[model samples]
Target: MVLPRNRDYFQIFLASLSPMIFVVLLLAELGLEWVYSLSIITLCYLASFIFWFKNGTKPAAWISKGKLHIRDGVFGTDVIYKDRLESMRYEIGHKRAVAGSNAEEAEMHILVIKMKGFDEWTLPIKDLIEHGPNLRLYKFIRDNFYNLKLVKK
Candidate 1:
């Protein structure tokens, strides 16, 4: 249960800067004053940078006798027993639109796991890390597990 490396700085920079670019473009079109527009864009850029710096790291992975442990944040980590897992499946092509328009969309690939006596938990792997590594991890879990009951919605 080895977690992959964090995304590089260039990727994070582009992700943080794209929204500021959009805001600047919108302000220009609306004929807003230069100081006000610049301030807004600057504030947004800084906030995005701070958020990315704080939450973008991959957590440590540990495998005990019959359980898997993963820590993705500062709060409570996830502990899953190998025997209790009932099913695991990849849910792809889920779309979410950004505010203000239907033209801007975010696609997600979620990995949902159902445990024996526990309610299902869906992890949004796409937003946390790169797609290839996430897909590899999902396949690894699916192959190593037993019965996999895919839920239909």
Candidate 2:
């Protein structure tokens, strides 16, 4: 089974912009021309788009037989055989809103598969509207790994 990346555009934009706006303002305060500061911010955003958009073309994860494959980067891929998997967990990472705000931002739900004698693999959940679209894929992963762990006990 192959899984989607499940990226949200609004989150990415906010993440990339929030820090950028602050830095640009700081630069403007530190004697840099406003035009140059704005240009710098624009360049940074362009770089981010180049990096993220290009990588969105690849598969985020796949499972074949008992092997789990995860894409790390353009040339880095990690593979873990089912038999070597130790334990697993799912977690939601959140971004606490500013002190004055009454909101929290959720980044992505991550499924962590721990394999024996190797580093754990963290893969994002694909259960989003345009991604996995349901819990079917999530259940598929949980059931498979849970059953394996159960049998080991």
RMSD from true fold, candidate 2: 7.2
Scanning candidate 2 in windows of ten residues, the lowest lDDT window is 144-153
Clashing pairs in 1: none
True-structure lDDT of candidate 1 = 0.63
Query: Per-prediction TM-score, please?
Result: 0.48, 0.47
**Which tens-of-lDDT digit does each residue in 1-153 have in candidate 2?**
776556655645554555566667677788777788778878887876666565655555678888866665444566767887787765544233445667754444556777788788866543333223454345556654344221110
- The numbered model that scores best in TM-score is 1
The superposed Cα distance between candidate 1 and the true structure at residue 93, in angstroms, equals 15
lDDT of 1 at 18: 65
Cα lDDT for residue 48, model 1?
Answer: 84
Count backbone overlaps in model 2.
0
